[model samples]
Target: MSAVRENNPVLTAIQAAHPVLADDLPPLQAVDVAELAAMDFKPRQPLLSPWLCSQDLAMVFAPRGVGKTHFGLAVAFAVATGGPFARWQAPAARKVLYLDGELPGAVIQQRLWMHCPDVDPAPGYLRIFTPDLVTEGRTLPDLSTYEGQAVIDAMIETDTALVVVDNLSAWARSGRENEAESWHPIADWLLSLRRRGIAVLLVHHAGKGGQQRGTSKREDLLDVVIGLSRPKDYDPQQGAVFVVEFSKARNLVGDQAESIELELVVADDRATWRCRTVEASTFERVVDLANEGLRPNDIALELDINKSSVSRHLNKARANGLIKADKAARS
Candidate 1:
């Protein structure tokens, strides 16, 4: 009779009981800023001391064949065994989960063996899930779908502390890397993982300009961004040499962002590839450029130094047996 009251029992009861009560309720919950500031907070543990902290979202980007995966694996091994990696030290051993969207199982196994031949395999310490093996003939997991949920479930079940997505382009479904909006969903999902105290490392490709390929928004959410690149004159026969530069770091302070040079040494049998940190210098850069088949002029231009300086460094490098000069270069 009175406009049917919209068939709402709770509202009708509230209206009949106290007409003025609704106005007295606070619309939102409030917390005291002073109280929040007084609460105790634990500092996050360092996964890679002084660089990558626990629960940090980081990215390692590089051009193809520059050893991004190799470097990622080396770091993963260190974190899993509480060992040292390059110049960084692992504070303690932690569980690691590696999602390999590229590379076959056999190849991954061989690479692991090459890097860790002396150490015995510690199961559950470092777990790997390749697309071929995990999906079992089905399509790879799309992070936008139920498959993504399943992957999260697996991470939880395994008690993973660190998860490495051995590539963003491969694992991110429906993501238009160039479009900022397309990355929102994936970025949010990664942030959610960080919120839960899980660290995530994304391997990505670099553009021709030597920056991570994608919307700059990708870097917005990442705490650390590492760029891997081979020297201008990298020679496979000599050894695999590359640079690891910290382009962006939220935790690193002054001088901490200095670049690191890495060399992959192999045994006579070529059964092992051990990564070691090498000194970075102008002489080393000159030698590398020369070895890469760059002429003195080209090397000078690349290093942005005078041609005379290039020749001086070249002479010094040659005098020290650091580089071999072709007869043509001498002429």
Candidate 2:
């Protein structure tokens, strides 16, 4: 009845024999390699130099209450405002879409105000969509459903350059975190975003052992993977200090791979909070000394730092798998 059916007698015969097979055949989309090679392709652009690049799918994981959301919001703000995030600089002010699945709108607003008290609100540059807004009359965006497609459509419609999913666990729907098969669909959807020149940042949780709480399959397609953890001697009143480690960064080289400490310093009036970066070598040294059979107090005296710093470093090192408890230390 159609040109394809009339021209291909064999295919017609096969379709005649099996009507269902005709419906199952996929359309062909083939490109010549030489033709593709001749076309001009844009070089990779960075959203955060040495950390996140355009078309990158990155993941940041941390244990509960370790400021994962706070840090993510800060980075999003930096990207939207075209400012420095920690030590990394955003090339220019870009539109960012933050999909919040955890915190309420009021809490998110409060945290944002504390981080940027003087910033005039720019709704066009920085947009936030909570779970209720995303799933108003539809289902959650699970990457395999129509609701997920709607989210992707919205991103494209908004011309968003960066999309931050507050957390994967809250929206992953029906997929078991530990199962590799569960991540296939999600990975494919994320890849689709990359193909459209959109960068994605996924916030995830760490397991009891401090590793990402899922199959490692998610990392296969990711360009960067970072982890966050609080110090062992974390004091609530001393401001929040946490270690940020680039466990995997496809773009970093040599010393650029080193981890850093992020501390949230409150102003004298406690009206504002600024995130600062500090060297994490003390923690590394503490791990090395502890592995070499020195006690925490001895390491503190040897490093000329305080006992609390030594303890905090040791705790972070152990959690990050840099060292294990020896028989001497276990006793």
Candidate 3:
């Protein structure tokens, strides 16, 4: 009946059997089957449904100049206002803290104004920390170190539910990019934040290989990992056309996992994005070989995906009537 999430079964059993030792027993430390099942812990609520949940850890990575900051700021605004951000909507407005190590104060202000020209943001609801605003020519604290974390931790108000770290390269400056061990401290810090019921969204840069830069170990503990890539037919003139794909989604399935083809149209002195669920699988590479009736193996080779994924997509395409089952069988 206690509201606390404390969960230890052996000690609980001892206290239940003998009330005399209840006061002397230490706090609960573990969860047993029955106790865990009976506990009244509530499910974590989403900041952005189907992706970011309370107490969750997530990341969005993209190549340089691919709109990582734009995406991060939009997410921050959406969470702060409880808004409809692309396909996701927050249940309610919540306090958010956004830390940016790269952009200037004027640039950020411009971006915020662009997002909401007529409406004023709720006061103190979305706190921002930019390197330009730091006092006495000091830089924003490095998130990879304890001292830096302490500084940022002090900046976070108790009511703040989400913290956005814009592009890890600038904030987490202490580590070697490719060394997995270099990211351990930052990873632990992120986990600690998650344990405290604070959700974190890390904006990141993509590597030369077109994936999240640095150690893959970072994804090992994350609840969601979004990768933004310019489409295969991407043109420099095309302002912001990127594919949003989930590389690691814990509970998402079926349509929830489909990649999004997002385009930002800037005209009439305004900027807004449009998104649609892509028809093909996330692995599709637009190969000329795929145009012909090729076997799954050949298609997989062209798509740079494994045989199993090719088979799965082929089945899904057929089931959705996007492709003919007979044609697939012939391939």
Candidate 4:
């Protein structure tokens, strides 16, 4: 009846808009394994070398106040300019549309100014839309529904190579984060973007457990998931300092997925970025944990790493004289 149809928002929206429904869409194409292999599909080139690529769906997440926005903006600027960002290098300049949800207009403006004083984006190459840009009578569209998805889709141009959504909480307003099905509409929209050869960078929040917040379903379709963790003994005065860890990566292994420590230092009138790979063999963490009086088992638990890794790091710490024989025995 009318009441039942009204209860389904998507169906109502489609009816009102007179658009094709899901059932009306064409069937998915399929081919034999050999036909699929020999389809002559173009190789996906790196958008950011070794990790992010053309048509990639990637997510970068960090706990609140851990510089997720800073990292997101840096990547956007680099890709929009075909420049270097920390350790990642964009091979060439491409069009980008950065959609900001959380920050105030003046704040994002100042940050962009700090990062680029004179270098401007190429004409039509980089565009930005923030919540502050919406008129007083209008609100930013949510990405959790098909209607919301269509509104944002209209903003994306054909030439736009990347879309940076920073981030879920602000942009996707109605979803229940813990429910996997609640994320479906948004996930399907993101996949549709990938099918159109557009890459997406999702900046999300990390839960107290230091993992991406919400259902793991968000990561099911992602090609790379980068985690930003605040350094222990972190100094509040030192803003935007964190270690970048790639928890999930495709087509990469070993050093390609190594963690990098990055710091943003803005002294005088200029800003500078510093980055370096964390040395795995140093096992400096073992020394720190031992000095803090955490036993090997506790250390492994706290670090969320295997006990074998704890043992190996402890051995390395001992070899480096970071732990005395007696102290090492107890730790």
The better candidate by TM-score, 2 or 4, is 4
List residue ranges in candidate 3 displaced over 4 A. Answer: 1-31, 38-43, 117-120, 280-331
lDDT at 28 for candidate 4?
87
* TM match of model 4 to true structure: 0.79
For model 3, the local distance difference test gives 0.78
lDDT (C-alpha, whole model) for all candidates: 0.75, 0.74, 0.78, 0.81
Better structure of 1 and 2 per TM-score: 1
TM-score of each: 0.76, 0.73, 0.75, 0.79
- For model 2, how does the per-residue alpha-carbon lDDT over 190-226 read when each residue is reduced to its tens digit? 8767877889999999999998898988898899999
Q: Pick the candidate with the highest lDDT.
A: 4
Best by TM-score: 4
lDDT of 2: 0.74
Cα lDDT, model 2, residue 16 = 43
User: For residues 34-130, what per-residue lDDT tens digits would candidate 3 score against the true structure?
Assistant: 9989987646878888788888899999999988888888888888888867898878888899998888889988877666523345898788888
Q: Report the C-alpha displacement of residue 142, candidate 4, in angstroms.
A: 0.2
Sort by lDDT, best first. 4, 3, 1, 2
What's the lDDT for candidate 1? 0.75
Stretches off by above 4 angstroms in model 2 are 1-34, 117-123, 132-139, 144-146, 268-297, 300-331
Instruction: Quote the positional error of residue 154 for candidate 3 in Å.
Output: 0.6
